[model samples]
Target: MAVTKRRTRRSKEEARALILEAAETLLRKGGPAAVTMRAVAGNLGITDAAVSHHFGTRQELLEALLHQGGRRLKDELNAALKEWRETKPSIQSLVDVIADVYADGAYSELALQLHLSGWRDRGSGLLNSVVDELHAMRTKAFAAGGRKRPSIQETRFAVGMMHQTLALDPLFGEDFRRSAGISSADKPSIKQRKEMWGAMLRAILEG
Candidate 1:
């Protein structure tokens, strides 16, 4: 009984740590495809069987990790929005928060994966649900105090721009800079990025 209890306790702790690390790595790198039992094993210096024993299946491991990441971002954004609201911040601040949600990181990476999967497997039925959730969030914001709403096409294009910002910006910058004989080592600042986001939001609003 003592041996079993000790093993159980260690297993839970190891699993918890493994999954948490896996989630952070996945967020920083790519999403589900970048995460694997072997990778976690390699990362934590554990056995594949140990990871498998804890996660059971790759799908389950992925779902759990994704869930954890989602919870973290949700908590972060919720706290930020609540604090901002208390200060009576303006509409642009709220728009920046919304834009930041779909900007980058694990959610954005996995979202692209899910979108591609949905295309390959039409019956998977994820794209529409995600679209609905985004729409609902937007509507809630509008009800809160948004001054305008873009048409469906405009909204779709605007969100597509935001969602792919990180991926596209570097590529766009590199090509343009290279053509101008400029090294791409010089990166834009956060202020520049925020200004770009604000400009995009403004364009959508004015559209």
Candidate 2:
């Protein structure tokens, strides 16, 4: 049975955007569980039914938000690759992009929720687009005849480093910051990130 929602059709886009904005805001202020359709609608001064009309359900809305974030991440990564591939790309540029990709404060906040959501919903596929994009870039790099070519798995893992950089180990934020050194501290900084990328990438390309 095809069920339909009741609401003015004018707010479809606005509703979706508002839902995501609310979700993000919720995650930033509290965490994922704090986000609710009713709360989001209230925040936007809209009705719950209106929000539901655009998202279908709460789960759908969360997944859609992740998917949207993933697509934008992939786009930025692809653009960075395009810039790096021109005229003997440097490891620094690659690392810079990696670091900068998730360095945005907005993404950082949303990413925490996505990770938590992934545990409960393994099939989110929010990052499928980004996963595919990474492979495509690796294939192109190898096909270029003179650049580095990492195994598809290796490419994905290297990209995963961004998440790892954000995760850190054992130390809390303040502790980590206090003990931060060149490589450790640099990994998180956009500037140092490019340097790391360049060095790691150059090694792989030369290998």
Candidate 3:
């Protein structure tokens, strides 16, 4: 007779994380439509009721995933800022960090789906720390060079534009580029576009 293998039990947090990971995998594999409760449960070898118990509904799961992405973006950006403080300021580095998070297109697609479903960010100010740090960095730089410092409004506008562009690029960048006369074969790669944005932002900040 063969012995049965026992399934390891997980804590609530662990199970929730695994469920989110499964949902994210589905999202990456088939975009937002793929990330359903059934699919997520199947991916994790869990029952629909189990997933519901953790997240209540698919909408809540998607919201949690988005928040997780935001937290990752914040952490990576904070790390980049720390490095910049140790060395010279590199706007391109910062741009690349944001681009990396949105490069896969999964997060962008998820965000669009949630917005279409009437989900809003609720002004959680997830990026408020980032905005504050960036403004402080710019202020220090300008003071060091004896130049006029950028107002907080200007900094906020610049950050908003940069973020919006990256967030939407995965969804619309190619189409927009083609519409602007760039051929599919001739259009810049995502990395190149990010670099261009970095240069443009640097000019705007340093001008």
Candidate 4:
């Protein structure tokens, strides 16, 4: 006789998490096109309507994933900054800390997909809200590090540029830069790019 696995009941939160995890996995493996309710439901051994009950639509599910992913990234950045502050605090340290976060391979990969999808389906507001929140977090982090307040416009601009560069790098960074003969020797690795962006941000915000 073959043993059959028992189906255990899950709480609402657990169910939502499972669905999102399935969807995220699909996204990572096959991009947005692969993330459909039916696919996610099948992955979870549930019906499409069951998954729909949690998110109503695929866009809603994607929005939830973006928010969740953004929060995780922000938390990681905050933790890195906090750990650095414990030793010594400075504007340079701030730059180094966040640059490392940008260079973080796993986070960067997932984030690139989520961001591309966000751009693909514009006007979601989820991505924009997260961006605004990240800006606030950076401002607070700067204050905590004893740097003069950064200007709102400059900070936003710096972050926007940084995100665009960081997000697109996986797809177009090497090829585009190589073709253009952009100096490969000092091509501002992720950390260096963040450092430079940070310095520019500091000058604009602290001046």
Candidate 5:
């Protein structure tokens, strides 16, 4: 006699996580166009209506993705902060750590998609809150390293520029740079670009 196999039931939280994970994978594989509710539902062997029950609209799903991305980013940023505290913060280390955070193609592509997909109308508040939190962390990190913390306004400017570069790189980074006739020597890698950006941010913070 064979034993019956039981289907594992997921709690609402677990199901929601599953849905978002599926969406993230799809987004990574084919960008935003492939991350519909139906697609996510199919990925989890559920119905589209079930996904809708968890996320009322496509915009809601996208908001959830943004939140998920934000949490992951926070974790990594926190680690970077810890590392900065342990070691003397150098421009190259800062550049390397920041480059690691933003280097995930899926994360950066989804970020750009969220911005372009009318996040302003849908869930800009959520994204803005995340940005604020990250900036606050940056301030704390600077203070930890005995560096002067930048004003909130200056901090916002520095972070905004960094975010913009990360978001656009996937869409038109290397190709655009090459098309503009910038040689490899002139056009630096993401890590190198962040070195310059880090220097600018450090200057603002120190001033």
Candidate 6:
């Protein structure tokens, strides 16, 4: 006679989290095309029905992934901003922080795919808080110097431009640079580009 072992059940939240974790792993390993229901279930030692039960469809899962990524970016940016406030507020540090997030290429590719699939942010405005913080900082600095303060709209536009450039850089920066005869070997270096963007943004804020 053999004794049977029973498996413990996971709570709903736990199951969903595990599923998302597995899906993200798959997304990072391959691209968005690799994050299938079957693949995620296989990674978690579960069934396809389990994933579908939690996320109804692949599109929903991808949307959740984007939301999770946005939350993570928000947290990281907030932490960096706190550190910047404690020390000197360098625009280069801020640009470096954002550039680091998209350096791996996974998030940028996923965002591109989702956008191509007609997926919209749906008013999430993930970077809105970041824009507000930057605006406040610039306003305070300008007032202290007796200079004209930049409008909130101007701050928003500047931040948006930085965000868009960083997001797209991981996907096409090399090619774009190569086309411009910048060399395919990162001759000017990514850090240089980030520094340039930072300087340009600072000028925008000050102007």
Reference-based lDDT, each prediction = 0.57, 0.60, 0.87, 0.67, 0.71, 0.87
Top TM-score: which candidate number?
6
Query: Which model, 1 or 6, shows the larger TM-score?
Result: 6
What is the Cα-based lDDT of residue 134 in candidate 4? 48
Instruction: Give the clashing residue pairs of candidate 6, or none.
Output: none
Clashing pairs in 1: none
Off by over 4 Å in 1: 1-18, 26-34, 91-107, 117-188
Residue-by-residue lDDT tens digits, candidate 6, 76-137: 88898789778977778888988898888898999999999998887656678678777888
Error of 6 at 196 (Å): 2.2
Off by over 4 Å in 2: 1-14, 25-34, 85-88, 104-153, 162-190, 204-207
How high a TM-score does candidate 4 get?
0.61
Ranking by TM-score: 6, 3, 5, 4, 2, 1
TM-score of each: 0.54, 0.57, 0.91, 0.61, 0.71, 0.92
Sequence-dependent TM-score of model 3:
0.91
Better of 3 and 6 by TM-score: 6
- Candidate 2 lDDT (Cα, whole model)? 0.60
Kindly report which residue stretches of model 6 are placed more than 4 angstroms away from their true locations once superposed. none
Task: Give candidate 4 misplaced runs (Cα > 4 Å).
Answer: 1-6, 89-152, 182-207
User: Which candidate do you rate higher for lDDT, 1 or 4?
Assistant: 4
Tens digits of per-residue lDDT for model 2 on 133-199?
5567567767786766557666556556544564332124435556665344344554443565566
lDDT of 5: 0.71
The TM-score of candidate 5 is 0.71
Q: Which residue pairs clash within candidate 4?
A: 150-205, 151-205
lDDT of 4 by residue, 39-142 (tens): 99999989999999999998788778766766665676566556654765445554554455445343455556666666443433323433454457667878
Report how far off residue 84 is in candidate 3 (Å): 1.7
- Candidate 3 yields a Cα-based lDDT of 0.87
By summed lDDT, the worst window of 10 consecutive residues in model 5 runs over 121-130
